[model samples]
Target: MTRPLRLDALAYGGDYNPDQWPEEVWHEDVRLMREAGVNLVSLPVFSWPQLEVAPGVYDWAWLDRVIEVLWAGGIRIDLATATATPPAWLVRSHPEMLPSDSDGRRLEFGSRQAYCPSSPVWRANVARMARAMADRYGEHPAVVLWHVSNEYGDHVARCWCPESAAHFRRWLEDRYGDLDGLNEAWGVNVWGQRYTAWEQIEPPRRATGPVNPTQLLDFERFSSDALLELFRIEVDVLREVTPDLPVTTNFMSLLRDLDYWRFAEIEDLVTDDAYPDPADPRAHVPAALNYGLMRSLKGGRPWLLLEQAASAVSWRDVNVPKAPGRMRIDSLQAVAHGSDGAMFFQWRQARYGQEKFHSAMLGHRGEQSRTFRETAAFGRELQRLAPVKGTRVRSRVALVVDWDSWWGSSATESLPSQRLGWLAQARAWHAALHALGHAVDTVRATGPFHGYDLVVVPNLYIADAAQAAALEAFVASGGSVVVGPFSGVVDATEKVHPGGAPGPLRGLLGIEVDEPWPVPDGAAELVELDGERFDAPVWSEWIEASGEASVVARYATGVLAGRPAVTRRAHGAGVAWYVSAALAEGGLVAVMRRALADAGLPARTRIDPDVEAVTRADDETDYTFVLNHGAREVAVDVPEGAEDLLGGDATTGRLVLAPLGVAVLATPRAAEPPFVTLSETTD
Candidate 1:
């Protein structure tokens, strides 16, 4: 198989819409882009209306001039297919192309991505647009990447329209063969919902009571595939026309609507648009997790930060701008996490549109804006840190991220507790691991567990037999594992495993779950670990220890007192830990620290709440990124014989970081301790 795409130098720029401005303003945009040391920009992302004009008629003169101007200014283009949104004329003629919500009301086409994924009309038009763009710019000197379409499923993830219903039925037929197989998979016999014919099936539309959980699960799977199918249509056209150029579409980080694992597998490269809320102090924790997933999507290949707000975003109720140095640190955070470079949503803030108020590289006041000054400085910093490109971030730890489990655990109805959300648990566990200073890479449940000492399963609500066996093999091979609650509950069909919770993993974890005992709302529960009390809220399980499993922590308060809130089992040469309660941050950290020790990894002595430390390495040198996200200035210990790349000075120890300050230290690879290499192959 061909490898994912990579850039020679650090990519630096944002979405550029020369079409949004006057012809004369295009010159100024390029001029400022050069001053900021910008080298790449994604263009004409939402230019379907401008390019197509009406029906088959075209308007290429304007786009030709824009590309010529960028090429003349020495800026590379991530040229879009200009199919993000369809022209008004097409939507007018084919109103049936518009999407419908779950309620089955046809949505209007006023905003972007307003078309149904299953619409043949929309697919044909987009494919045509992709071919046109590739035929025109496939060999253009300025074009480096072929941006497929804008973020898929950003606005319309799923459609309940008649066309979508038809597509879903077709997909179901292929997935489960005939009626008997479908009946068995969905267990439709429960409520007299078994289908006699394929035509009887429809998209899971509005229903009086809770919809069949299995039906809902299938619908979610089908919806993700529908969007992926749309992407494939455009990708097939692009690759055929421009076989040499790499193609990609921006992914909304950790988006629930689509399975990015499948999407990334087909695309030539992975990219993401991340907007961690400025209002939340700890937003970066989850942002790191998202970035990890992006990098892991292509097996640790460097992805791009395709879009991030330069400052305040217009969509939030309270649009908070980034603090003085926050933008620089935020951009570097992406670099630290394995992004080749940073790019924003728009090169210039829109003068008039839904996103006009969104902050950009150039604001309304142009260069005089604070946003521009900070971003320009950051762009220069990116130039100085260019060598950091193409380097991989090494981690001995892996976290399981499964889309099926996310859908199963967060099913709108029939969940044991709505609070046991997949993302919430993922972020919570990742935060503790982050606090403990382990560079975490995300993995699928059925992992290629090579080159890692520890694997963590935050929650695996839909663990199948294969996934269980994979984890079992990992542990038997002497890799320590830490599993959180709500795992191994169901099979691929959403049917409960023959046994209770942790079904397939019962043998590996050495425990059988009697029942899930969720803590009541507004109630308090505590657990004792190592003779220290800690809050264990939201969830707990009635776990019966089988075999030689040992209880590591017990419920000190609540009705389930003295029961196992945490258990550990020695399997083969490795250890398996089960955390049955949704332990508070402190409690989770305590459990994680123990797991780290068991895996022969040293837990950091002190973890700063607002500081992040990450290392990226090439063959001969290690680049350590230390960033301070807190308000107060603090000093950090630097590795011996390290040179500060940003400061252009040699520093040995005691590197002080101002609030939001960042430092990149270069040290000889041999000087650092022996590192475990991550194998690219999957188990």
Candidate 2:
């Protein structure tokens, strides 16, 4: 897991496709890039077919010229292996390379990423092309990082073809060791279906009846592993050719198909492609949540914001343009969270293709446009803030992000409510913490939680015995825990545990839920806490205190009215809070405040509610970012003697931030011990 050479200035740029335009446009593109202060650009992301003329021959003349031009222009290259899209001739020759949908429908080559993940020929071609690219451009002075296959599992994640079925069988063999083991894990006896031989197993396709839940869970896991293996193949070739080269793949964090935790162990850094919908009011929190999750992959190390929409994207049905100053705030927002680099999907807007309408730094109208002006200003500001590099975002609260739970919950229709999205619940808690001015980290559920003041297990829809044990130990060690609705209801295999709901965690939580009362879509019930009533929506559970727990909130109106809607327990000198239903922002913030207080943590800052402040620190300086995402100006309280790194000036008193404004302040950093350090004794 090597990273590229440390950048003197924050890297800024996006994917650059020079081959699409005439040779004359290349010169102007470079000049424009220089004007916008773009120091890094990803090249040839979709140029696989352009490089390979037929089968084995590669015409690298065009690519070599592109590299030399960008290098001469003083722009670093995030060089792509260009194995994203294959040549039509190869697919026509070997149609078995095409992936199939769950319904056994073959995906054609008209779109990108249509190849089967299990096809050996596809793997061979991708690796061959990767090696050729690495051998040719690995030594290029401008090349800084190697971007592996563009966004794996974007379109063709799971396939039901014969080749894929064979691969699935092999993966099952490796996982289960024997048919009896597979039967036991899958609980095949449920439907009088048990596999006696390897040949009897098949991919979960569009079957005549419902597929087994355990079978589907394993299939999803196997599919993710297949894609990971495919990526490993290309990365192996790239590393073999250039051992020191840092390699990365852009991850779409919201996509549930790929298991990014396992992928993070292989990819050099947790580089992700993030596109926040302008229409969603709560979009920024999820964006920050994803960024925090990405940064968490490297143990609080800074990560790359690989791709974001400059103004608008082409995929959405009603793509809205980002208002003036929005781009600058969002770009700086990335840096404030933990990104060493900020990049967009495209540097210049495409003239043709499905994504031609996608917004870019230099739009179709060129440098005179508003987008270009903002891009230039942001780049110059990033250049002035080089001291902020190498700093990491520190969080006192960690939200367990379990991909297994995500896949199992979403894929199964039998779950309480389909609206229970994994990230949605996690984002709810993160949003609550952000409102309270507490920085949060979204780490994998399996990661160690040694130094967090609070560990929020949002809808532990699925859990394991070991995971439950760890949480119990964390609570016993004086660490506060927040267990969201329906937590610990299912085990690791997506199976309901034998005990009552919230299973093994009943002891730590001091509550037992025999059944869940799922509120239908668009219906809500009132939760009353301390004479304040708030609408609790989505889900609620029938709870009874089995231990030393007290009712914090009760359902005011519903079938479970007067029952416990939220509970708190004093457990082993620590506290465990259970939110039985999804609450609106106001209620969640109140609950968060109570949790923080119970954990002996300080209250949130005294800043304007509209402005978000996140502080990242190195050994010597604290870099605080104040961002205004509201529609009106807001007053912010700045720390005394802080320097305005963005404005190149400093001032005390109330700092006013206009709508969509941003400010970066750097002050002498103080030594901060873990907000919650581990000890044998409880606090």
Candidate 3:
């Protein structure tokens, strides 16, 4: 579990672009902030060009006044260093800092994140700017957090150029120590492509023949590390100047290019920017999954929902307003998952700009409209539930998050098929646990796994012997595991493991796979679990038990009909299960529920499908948040003696929730805290 924000309760409000308006309008903005219970506002996100008008020079006059005004109005400020967008002067002077795409075309500097992450010139300039910002505002009373570069690697995730090639070579040398090791790992001898010198290697850029799998994987890793290095330079400066203020950069959730597991470790707090389209039917599922992963990034600590659309967003082809109360419900959902703060992208809608159509707490009409009223109401609700602050969600389930597997499967050409889902397959497994009402953490498959009773590794395509050993030991020590198909098929170097597939942990699974059969481009098949038939249209493998593994499910039809589709083996004190195909949504849910039962983990709360139930606990109470995302009313059977926080009354049974409605049930705890942690207080 996690804890509170800057003050006694949840922090609110978001990006405030006071520079866009005149100084006379500043007082009115502050007045509106106070009325809406705005507590925190991030400042100067895209202000690099404005901050540095000339080379090696900065103008901080407007930012200083804005911070002072917000502080006088009793609002905390999340100070951004304003390096997300580089100044045109800097880019124009050093054109080498501009990033090139995979096609070798240099992208122009009219947009944000224009500087190449691997460019040394860009890094040095960004460092000076970060230091200047930190020195000027380090001691400000209103600033409680330092916001690093906004959403690293969002637009320019990869840069392919001669400079990038040099950086990639250095990164590889650091990892493998020598050219011989790189040759061996990449298996360059296979295509008469052995490297004799350090300069012989280049990034996987614009190739006619298939690029080396390991080369492609290494390039992805290098790009992620390059972004990390850029962010760390700013983080180091902030720690030196504002040592006590928490530092964080908002992560765009599930960004495939940047490695979040690596980025999360270097920051003081983890925060994410989520803008799920209200019109998509599967929007909330991904949002929920990302929230769980974001919370887990800091060890299930209290993270913040740094940005969300109060109504509609600008970038999408279609911008749809959030149905009434949907914003409130989703905001609270972030809290239920483990957010200590709820914020949006903009406090006020911009009059003219790229994101002018983006919705904000105070739209163009100001605070006299529905958006402002809803924002104010949500603020008041956060104030009422202040007691729930500083609490965390507890869970015994963990889902494996492996970046190497992600790159190995998607960035390379060795995938069984182009349609073989990478991260989607992984998130599908999480969706199953979520559907069953169990809290789950997404953690690294190669890292230390602890305090988790059940670990689910979905599509972990790349696993070394050491990783396999760790999983074996975990299962041997009374921890249940559910392994997905196509896992443990290769090593970290993108080389297929010797012997059959699932090389290292094959014995733990007690089964051997013959070959994987991908569903035809336009076909689907069925598998039978117990007595129920389920469609599986992804990939299936032929499996035969080696020792003690028993078949759990089998393909009902096909040339290899009646073959084992799923298997389970009883290890020393725990059980290891495996799913050998991409099952339908319901099939995945059924398998996961059975796996949870095998691990003795029960649902936190049983409710309707569209209603989400999550519990968070503090020193005294277990706060259950039930939110109905459906369009119709749903009845929830209330537990005895539970008091409804919204109604301020004790409820006995049968509470009906209208569409987009929410209810908080507080139940007293008599035992010790649910899950033990490193600290009792977030302070």
Top candidate on lDDT is 1
Evaluate all candidate structures by whole-model CA lDDT and list the values in order. 0.87, 0.82, 0.83
> Residue 275 error for model 3, in Å?
1.0
Model 2 vs. true fold: TM: 0.95
Query: For model 1, how does the per-residue alpha-carbon lDDT over 1-683 read when each residue is reduced to its tens digit?
Result: 44444356789899998887899999999999999988899989999889888888889999999999999999999999988888899999999999999999999978899899999999999998899888888888889898987989889898999999999889988998888999999888787888998999988888888888888888889999988988999889977887878889999999987999999999877899999998898888899999989989988888889999999999988999998888888899999999999999879999898999999999899999999999998898788888888888877899999999998777658878887788889999999988887778999999988888999999999988889899999999999999999898999899889977898999899998999988888886899999998887799889988768999999998788999889999999999999999988999899999999999986766766577777888998888888788887777666656787898888656677788888888887753332222123222
- TM-score, structure 3 vs. true: 0.96
Ranking by lDDT: 1, 3, 2
Model 1 whole-model lDDT (C-alpha atoms): 0.87
Q: Write the per-residue lDDT of candidate 3 for residues 32-147, one digit (tens) a residue.
A: 98988899999888897788889867688888888888889999988899988888888899999999988889999887889888899989988898899989998888888889
Query: Runs in model 2 with CA error above 4 Å?
Result: 605-609, 671-683
Q: How many residue pairs clash in model 1? A: 2
Candidate 1: residue 243 Cα off by (Å): 0.8
lDDT of 2 by residue, 242-322 (tens): 888788999986578998888888878778898888776556767777788788877887888889888999999899988
**Deviating ranges (above 4 Å) for candidate 1:** 1-7, 670-683
Quote the positional error of residue 627 for candidate 3 in Å: 1.3
Better model by TM-score: candidate 1 vs candidate 3: 1
